[model samples]
Target: MDGTTLYAVDGGIARITLNRPGARNALNDQMIGELLDALDRAKHDDGVRVIVLTGAGDRAFCAGADLDGLGRDGMGVNDVRDSAPFRLFTAFPALGKPIIARLAGHAVAGGLGLAAACDLVIAADDVKLATPEVNVGLWPMMIMAIINRNVAPKHAFKLYYTGSRITAAEGREIGLVTEVVPRADLDARVDELAGVIASKSPLGLRRGRDAFFAIEGRPLEDQVAYLLSELVELAGTEDAKEGITAFLENRPPDFRGR
Candidate 1:
């Protein structure tokens, strides 16, 4: 609420922007809390079908955690376990709605964690990504779990160990980014994807995304069974019925998020 983060909803999409351009939109405790709050708002708002997270300014999507704000003291186990920044990472998947990261510039350390937490990430072709905690005598311990899931283990370890950076195209190759486009095309590309996703059945998106996160660590057989039941539940939703009828009638479906 300190204006370090901005949140707005329009056209069924919730836009959450980190507003600290002067600091390259670095994550501070307040900013992390604001972002988590915004995510919660969007998740509960029936009118919001999609969320887009981005940083202010063209210089950087995020330069990572604000070292000054993070301070130089080791924390007790309780403090470490209850850190607010950790909420930002977990909130995305728990929201049960699609989140797209609009990366206009570099994303390093915690910044990369934020992007990786999103369901999809679209970055400018010239943008870069890195996990440079090692360069500063620190480890990206909080984000490692997310980075591990998104990037190949060997490649991720190499980046973490060497403190190297990768271009957006390279990020796409490593499965860290979903799409890369010219800087000028970034907004259009993000809007296009958000609009397309926003037009889908909200109930379907929420249910599917929820199932996605839930079945992640399950066995293959269990996953198949759970997914089958999830599909049956989805089929019973009013939006699903309307979607089917609309398709059969060659008409646009009006989903009410039922």
Candidate 2:
């Protein structure tokens, strides 16, 4: 759908690939616009139940924002807000659908933010994730916002401060990754999860997700009370009726994503 970002579908899964491998898939202006457009479309499209994001070629899922041509074409530090890497991850919570990151290689700087933005991430076992902006006399301060949400504050601080790279397993341990499989199994693992999501009820998934974040960090007593009330609303849905009936009948529920 976009030049720097590749889009494809298998069943209900929409796979969005970063295509600038030669540039280490660094996110540039073109890639950003395309990705935002694509994500917005996916959120509204009923045909797309799950979306998986990865980078083309194996060397890098994304190396972060492209720095090579900075100031070469009327771009400055301020102009960077329009860059794809910045826009993609920063506005992620607004994306109403589930995004699975299929990280095949290194995720650096802005790439790290993208990885952290996904609702879930299934990365290659050998994948390396880091935000090395400090090493270059810069800081991943912006990306750190997204990182702080998924990873422990201390862990996020340690990686950003040291500017050192960590393996996919370590990333998982620190909570940025949901699963890590061998390189050979990367696609298969992503596909498997995507299929699982595709089979479920989209409306229920979206509603639950929307409510999930709203409830985070709230007091346990308050959250529990809120959730209890929320269930009443869900029970009013047609999809919930099917789920309850299917459970009683001991059969899979046919969800229309209502």
Candidate 3:
């Protein structure tokens, strides 16, 4: 796992780079295992205030599962979800920290699932996004699960049934991306966002993020209850104390990603 998946930390930002450029960062079993493990590691590591997911080269953030994840020993739709697709990131909302997908290249099929599941996504204007599995006789079944959560049903169906690739700019319009920047500006933009995220109290960030998703599918009364519960839970965390003290002192508070 040491060289197969590169992990780097600068300030509070942890970057997870999928290292199989030769395979276009495809989700081979090893890559899948490593990504899950890396996400687990990123969540537990206090130094990691936010995570940035990217690939090793210019060709793909991921081309979805490897050519192998589709064939004889390949994953079926449900298997891909359980083994490597949306489940990996679906487990993420509980982490209470931001995970941003820095789409430096193409994100198709399950690769698009990666971007869809992230808390934020930023990509180059030229970055390609698609659920091209239909062209190969498979619909974007697993990817569709998350896609429906993030996108309109009709558009999600259009992406699945058509299998046409879209630019990152179009992805933003369709709710699949957060921002589209020039290729040269992708990293700086993600880094800037990471810094802004780090500026907030991590405890409140986690509470709010959890409440946000928890309330999304709930009624108004339930939403208020959930938010109130989150507030109570957050009041017990250290960041609350630091945040209040910092305001009183008129100085920046250093956060510990507790």
Q: lDDT of each prediction vs. the true structure?
A: 0.89, 0.84, 0.82
Which candidate achieves the best TM-score against the true structure? 1
- List where candidate 2 sits over 4 angstroms from the true fold: 69-86, 217-222
Kindly report which residue pairs in candidate 3 clash with one another: none
TM-score order of candidates, top first: 1, 2, 3
| lDDT tens readout by residue for model 3, 75-102 | 5554544444455657767766788999
**Candidate 2 residue lDDT tens string, 125-207:** 98899989889898887778888988888998899899999999999999999999998988888888899988888878887
List candidate 3 segments past 4 Å from native: 1-3, 69-87
lDDT of 2 at 242: 93
- Residue-pair clashes per prediction, in order, are 0, 1, 0
Worst 10 residues of 1 by lDDT: 71-80
Name the lDDT value of residue 258 in candidate 1: 89
